[model samples]
Target: MDTVLTLAADNLLSPLILFFALGVLAALARSDLTIPEAAAKTLSLYLLFAIGFKGGVSVSGHGVDGDLVASMLAGTVLSFSLPFVAFAMLRVTTGLSVVDAAAVAGHYGSISIVTFVAATSVLESAGIASEGYLVAVAAIMEAPAILSALWIAARFSADTGNPVDARDRQGLLREILLNGSIVLLIGSFLIGYITGEDGLVEIESFVVSPFKGVLCLFLLDMGLVAGRGLRSSAKHLRPGLIGFGLLMPVVGAGAGLLGASLVGLSVGGTLLLMTLSASASYIAVPAAMRVALPEANPSIYLTMSLGITFPFNLTVGIPLYLSVARAVGG
Candidate 1:
């Protein structure tokens, strides 16, 4: 417990989190600080490429094995199933309609790339080594939740009038699978795997040396976006919704820990898996929701995922996960 608190405090004070705080504060105070959209997009691309490539390189060295296959399978199951749990919880805890609940559930079930990156950064800072294949796990986790959410809506909701046409459904599938982030991440991962250590040597300075700094900047933009959401969407977030946002990550992390234990992941790998499971997708899920379930409220899902869960995961949840991993993983 003490170790958890210490790590949480250290994380809270880290430059990345602090920069994020600065953006939130600036947004709240209306200070007009903003990252250009194009620059933010470039940063996003850089991060995906770097992390994916590094993961590929790691896998190249480690080679494919049963453990990697098992981890990927476990991650897919969690991604497909977690939305059901989240949907049930939402139905019982909040007044969200079946469609909205399913939409929001998709966010919880899908993985957040930024949050995954943040957890990796925390692990690196703490000198913990995790599996590189987890990046592939993250990519695998992104789409299944959308499928589950659609299934839930079709099965449970009788009256939304099918906002998604067959054409829209096909487009949504493409968007979910071929989103810019996923494409860059998986493509770069393959490139790195092919190039291996020699590639890393050639590009270490570009990807490795500047990673933390780039992450700090990206997080600042995220903070600003979160702050604006929290500021403007307070009306949509009732007490039940607020509680759900805060509660679901812990629930997801517990499910992840169970999966990690089953797969016999190491402490660092366990923490990363927990973090991935606990994260909510603000990127791909929302776009899918917009196309597939256009009636659902973006404010509710986006604010819950980005404004509340993302910050909590960064500031407190990651440390607790690390502590729990250390205790159980040993």
Candidate 2:
């Protein structure tokens, strides 16, 4: 208990957590703050590249293993299946329509890159190592939930109009699979894999050493984005909807812990998997929903996930999960 408390304290003291807190506090205070969309986009790209490239380099030395494959497969399966559970839970627990329930569930199904990054920091602080191809696992998790959400939305929102337009459908599909963040992440990971450690040598100055520093700066921007999202949507969200945001991550993390145990992941990897399971997609899913399920409230999902739950998971939840992973993953 002392150890858990200490780690939790450490998490709260971290700059990443602080930045996230700033977002929540600023939003709750109704600050008129904004992060430029272009800059936020660029920061996200940088974060993905730095993390993916580093992971690729690490994997270059580690190579692939059976357990790694098992873990990835487990993560993928969880990503695909968790939404149905979330959808069912939401329908029963709240008054959300099938479309809203499924849409929110899809966010739970997908992975959150920032949450993963935060977990990686916690692991590093604990002097633990995780597999790099988990980056690939992260990429894989993003799309399946989207399909699940769309499937549910289509079923419920037949009357929402223009459900089957070819051009729009194809574009959203392409965006889902080939989204810039996912593309850059996978592309950079593969490039680093191909280049190996030798490749890292050539660009180490760019992707290494300064990675965490860049994360701090990017998180500052994320703070602003998150704050803005929450403040603007504050009036629109009901308590049940907001409560759904908070509850979903806890449910998802419990499911993730079970999955991690089945796959025999290390503490670091297990915590990361749990974090991914708990995180919601502010970027990809919102964009996709805007294109596809236009009636589904972005503010409800985005604000609840990004504003409330994100800071919670980043500051308090990651360390809590790490402690749990250490206990269970051992």
Candidate 3:
């Protein structure tokens, strides 16, 4: 308990979190602070590429092994299955329509790359080591939730008019698989793997030195966006929705803990897995939901995921997961 509180304090006081809070406060106060769209996009790309490349470099140092394979399989299973759990929970807790529930469920099921990166930063600060292949796991975890959500909507929802046609499904699949973040992440990972230490040596100055600063800025932008969403979507913020947003991540983290234990992850790897599972996707899944479940309410899902869940994970969930991982997996 002491350790958990300490970690949480440190995390809350970190520059990243503080900047994020500043952005949120600024937004809530209707201050005109903003990161330009293009700059924000660049920051996103830089963070993804840096983290993915470093993960590959770490994999190069460690070499492929059974744990890597197991982690990937476990991640895939978690991604595919977690939405079912989330959907069931949402149904029990909230009066969301089946489509809205499924849409929210998909966000819970998919991994948030930003959250994963933040966890990595936290782990780094703590001088902990985890498998680099977890980036691949993060990538793998992005799409399966969409499939699960679509399945849920089709299975339970009475609305049949918006059924996705074959072409639409294909396009949605392409969008999921070819999302720019995923592509850059996987592509950079492969590049780093192929080039190995030599690649890292060449680009260390570019990718490593500027990483945390970039992340801080990106998260500042994220805070602004989340704040704006919350401010504009206040009407959609029901108690049940907010409760699910807080509760579901803990449930997902528990599932991740089980999976990580089964796969024999290190304390740090276990924490990363837990963080990935706990995170609700605001990027890939939201875009997919827009395409695949257009009838679903974006304000509800977006506010729940970004405005509620994202901040919760950043401020509380990651530290809590780390404490549990240290207690059990350490």
Best by TM-score: 3
Worst window of 10 by summed lDDT in candidate 1: 159-168
lDDT tens string, model 1, 1-330?
A: 799999999999999899999988988887788999999999999999999999999889989899999999999999999999999999999999999999999999999999999999999998899889899999999999999999899899996685577787888888878888999999999888899999999999999999999999999999999999889997998999989888999999999999999999989899988998999999999988887888889999999999889999999999999999999987
**Model 2 lDDT tens row, 1-330:** 887899989888888777767765665676765567787777778889988887888788889788768877888888888888888887887788776777788888987898888788778777999877788888888888888888877876665567848887788888889988888999999888888999999988988777777777677777777777766877857777777777888888888888878887777778888888888887888788777777787777788778777877887778888888888867
Judged by whole-model lDDT over C-alpha atoms, candidate 3 comes out at 0.94
TM-score between candidate 3 and the true structure? 0.99
Ranking, TM-score, top scorer first: 3, 1, 2
The count of backbone overlaps in candidate 3 is: 0
Pairs of residues clashing in candidate 1: none
Model 3 residue pairs with clashes: none
TM-score of 2: 0.92
lDDT of every model, 2 decimals: 0.93, 0.80, 0.94
Q: Compare candidates 1 and 3 on TM-score and give the better one.
A: 3
Q: Can you tell me which runs of candidate 2 are displaced by over 4 Å?
A: 26-35, 156-158, 165-170
Q: Compute each candidate's TM-score over C-alphas.
A: 0.98, 0.92, 0.99
